[model samples]
Target: MTNYDFVIELFIRVDDAMKNMPKHSQAKLYPSELVTLGLLYAIKGVGERAFFRWADRDLRPLFPGLPERTRFFRLLATHQDWTERFLAEPTVLGIIDSYGIELLHPVREREKTLVREREKTLVREREKTLAPRIATKGKSNYRWIMGAKYGFLLNQLGLIVDWASSWIGTRPRKAITIPSSNP
Candidate 1:
């Protein structure tokens, strides 16, 4: 199908699904409109400012009442639950995986320590914040790193089913759970 046809079909499906959801009387944008914008944003994979600009210029005809950036973001945040549910529809097969998200480079640790020492007088009265106390040392297949872990569940089509993150030292079993749809 053409891109226009696909978008129309997607909007129809999303609108029908969201029809039974709760609504805010003061909301200027309908759930369908919000979801459509969200899908467009995700597909475009652009930052919020750029997406807003594109929508303002190209999609204004389709979304005549598009709000300003701040209001648009607030609307998205308010309707996040609906969008999440719509995106997480079940699939035939799924995969779960995780990897480390390094917050700081090991080489930078020494520099950080030196900086902290220089600023000791300024932060003397405050608590002594240490890296070990904050981030745990963890090992990945490739290398050892000190950082947090990010986990995700993806469907057969590679869409994110769910995702989470935890401290580096935490095990995936304890940090993440895949909810059973059976009951």
Candidate 2:
């Protein structure tokens, strides 16, 4: 059917995209295996681990030979930049956003000096500068998130024209402009 061909074309496109990516050393999974894994991911739209099993069963015949899970992870970590480039591609003909990837929570390390300065500022403010925080529910009925609403401006091609991220506080934080270095 048409859908089947679409999937096949998408897989081929994924493989083609991998050609431009950086390669790795050491004997492990082939770049083709990594491409198949990525295609399976795009089609299934599931978690990373799920795609591995899917690749083992459904994709094995397509690849005919794939390294074990260890090799798969190794290949994945080694070629992470390719994954980012693959996801960032304007395949949809417009901007797209995805948060499906469950990455490991990074270790939180506090900067002692920065924390001390913030503490000093808090002390200086005292009760005179204390502002009562009011909780407001969003129109969507989603749980109240104590954060500022942020949006990134992307052109029609989906490349980030600019990005602005700010933390929630008494007053709106100033938007910092990110210049496009390419131009």
Query: In terms of TM-score, which candidate is strongest?
Result: 1
lDDT: worst 10-residue window of model 2 = 99-108
lDDT of each residue in 1-183, candidate 1, tens digit only = 965677678888888888886656987677788888888888989999999998888777777778999899888887766776765654767888988888777677678778869888865544365533567667765887778888888888888878777777776534445667686
Candidate 2: segments with Cα more than 4 A from true spot: 2-7, 20-28, 87-153, 157-183
lDDT of 1 at 156: 86
Instruction: Write down the TM-score for model 1.
Output: 0.64
lDDT of 2 at 133: 33
* TM-score against truth, every candidate: 0.64, 0.44
**Global lDDT of each model?**
0.77, 0.51
Candidate 2, residues 1-183, lDDT tens digits: the string is 554465567667776766755545754455655765655666678876777786677656556557787767677677654554543322223342311111111121134335657788674565355434322222112333343444454546667543343333223244534334353
Question: CA shift at 4, candidate 1, in angstroms?
Answer: 4.7
Q: RMSD of each candidate?
A: 5.2, 12.2
Error of 2 at 173 (Å): 20
Segments of candidate 1 deviating more than 4 angstroms:
1-6, 87-94, 101-149, 155-159, 166-176, 180-183
